[model samples]
Target: MLILGAHYRLAFTHSILAFSQVINAATHYQLDYPDLALILALVRGGSLARASQLLKVDVSTVFRAVRRLEAALGQQLFEKSRAGYLPTTLAQSLAEQAERAEQALEAARIGVEQGGEVISGIVRLTCTDSVLQGLLLPALAQFMPNYPALTLELSTSNDFANLSRRDADIALRLTRTPPEHLVGRRLADISYRVCASERYLQSVNTTDLASLTWIAPDDFLPDHPTVSWRRQTLPGVTPGYRCNSMLSVTELVRAGLGVAALPDFLIGDGLRPLGEPLHGYDTVLWLLTRPDCRALRSVVTLFDELGRALKLP
Candidate 1:
């Protein structure tokens, strides 16, 4: 009986010591929220320069913050190599926890911001430049005046904004598949058509499409549907002009510079459709927001308004 009782005491003592060590470690590492944010961004970005861009700080600032974090923790969080900074196992675990904390903090902030009865706050919207000019801005011009207290900020980028990180409150994107985490619906089916100015069509032989001067998306957009379509359908034909911007290609088509494939919605005023909508190149336009932000009055109002205005018949 004495031996069994002694064994139990030994186990209890070890448990207490282990608990104490955890407490001591926790007390030793006094990590700030901003530090945690930096860690998360670094893990996501995989480079100091990219992290700095995400955090809106200088590269030196990001580097110093990382060094400070390592000093506090007494361990390296990342493996630096020529390729990029790779997160250690410990860093990945910490970043996961930090992400959860970030989401909670963002939820709380949204709750407080929406607590007031007035639907007034900034809603940051992000989308590609073509979508901004061809679709959203026109609808927003009509929608914004209705909400006098609200402010709408726009960000144009080809890459989808990271909605999980609250990079933007709302996003309008053209994709076959929208991120599952975002709350939204497909607004419209985007179809492409061969388009040119009426004068260009009259000037060129309509019977031989391969012989006409073609305007194409530049090598920068090699993966663009029109680029692939032109390459596959027309084979040996070469374009007369190439542009990096889809909007610019549309403008060139309207100016009679050359014929180009354009989304049906962009075939406005001076442009005329030369052929039917292309097959297997249809994409859907989506209006999306973080699930947490969907409940915000301002976001909800703008989301609904944009949905209604942008939905194609």
Candidate 2:
């Protein structure tokens, strides 16, 4: 009976050892959070292009991530086809787990953001150059000094930053319809006016609208309101100058180069509006932030400050 008990104890010890080895081997390779995020995106989107779009990365980036994950796991996660990448069963399963982890991480982030009275950390904001120079910079100059610990970084872009991907913590944009996913309210109506310098107005026959030299946005800005407005307002008349930047157009008008439609916010000194705000080029200035970040103290504070400072009287 003593010998039988000794044999049973040896077998139990071996079983425990084997289980420990299995766990060690399983945990040897640490899965990257970025790779897991890519996997979840691919599983949800079902294609490399779709995943890239959702992740705000290049298609090659997603492809390389898949290869890296497969190599680390020593298993194939996806099968390539003409239709796109089809996730294997393991990929789907892992994605499900990763989604849960992602949710937990997001909740954790929100909790940390709302945890304290401290309004610190960097807040990234994206907007057009004109808005930065004319509207936001001044307001920020006054507001930022109050919060010494908080840092505000600005990125100027012609296109809207992808808030879902966290390209910027906040965005100030001029649009007729703001994106549904973002949280914000319109600050004020953005009105456009036909403006020119005193010198240009004096040189041209103001009475003869067709004969005056005109400044307009170049073909690169095909979707710009000025482009469409010019096409509709002056069918055959060619512009004297063309520029891709609205700020540059404003400068040209200020230099007495020609007349152009400019946003009301950009009508600084040295430029005068030739007429009342144009009829069809109505837009609004929207102050937007990610829904997840709405509760963040820094974001909330800046958002409220900008809303108050920028609201038109």
Candidate 3:
């Protein structure tokens, strides 16, 4: 009985000692070099010899960096084989943290050098193709002159831009209700009218919905007022031609393919609005962003400029 108790006590004490050592080792390993040192050396420099030359350090210095990184991580972060020092599972898991750290560090460096200077960080805006054509480009042309140092990168995608995820700094959307976790401001209650080319008016009568050929956008947005009107009024109606972009739809309709319902902003000077008014086709344009980005100067400026550009006389 005494021997068994002693053995049990010894095992428990050793387990506690092992756990304490793990915590101590983890706390002691401090990384002094810049973030992504190991990964950058491995990817860009290719081998230790080339990496050391590029990093302006000795080969053993690079080796020690790898060792220190592994020690800091308290894991076998890499393995030496005939091929090279291959990263272990833990290194791969920490990849995103390293990248994020590098970005934060870059932001810090920029802040230090450009302190009290004008705004200069790149502004990434997410906009729909339609908004890009109708609102963003013209607004940007006018707004950019005011802020010379700020750079703009417009990302035009139909997918909902998750502002919290940094998908875009700002977005222009048409919605009656703003989504949760987003800050939305109503810009305009945008109206549209049915219009067609003069050639099409001469060839076909578009006074009524039936027996009138129409050109429509290829992808149907469920919330689109015109699309909803068409589905509600003319269920079996199929257009002669369908294209994705508003530009394509306008061009196809202008070619006298068929009459199309278009926003006045998208219409050229030549096209005439039809007399017949479609119901359930008025929508409100909105500017939206995550709360954090909404406070950003770039996004707020975009909202202000874009809202001004969208108004029609």
lDDT of each: 0.79, 0.77, 0.65
RMSD of every candidate to native, in Å, equals 13.1, 14.3, 13.0
How would you encode candidate 3's per-residue C-alpha lDDT over 1-313 as one tens digit per residue? 1122343344334433433343335466544335355655554554678768867889998888877766666667666777776666555444434543444344444444555324434567786677788777887787677655556777876555556677777777766666777876787776777888888788776657567888887665545666677778788888777776666777777787777777666777668788555656777777777788766765677667766766644
Can you write out model 2's per-residue Cα lDDT over 43-84, one digit (the tens) per residue? 988898999999999999988888887887777889988888
User: Taking the tens digit of each residue's C-alpha lDDT, what string does model 1 give over 1-313?
Assistant: 1122343344334433432343226447655568778989999999999999999999999999899878877778899999899998778876876665554344334334555233455688998778999899899888777665566888886555567678898899888888888889789999899988988888788778899899988987787888888888999889999998788899888888889899887888988887789898878899999989967887898899999989977
Model 1 ranges with Cα > 4 A deviation:
1-116, 162-165
Candidate order by TM-score, highest to lowest? Answer: 2, 1, 3
Reference-based TM-score of each model: 0.60, 0.62, 0.60
What candidate 3 gets wrong by more than 4 Å, as runs, is: 1-116, 311-313
Worst 10 residues of 3 by lDDT: 1-10
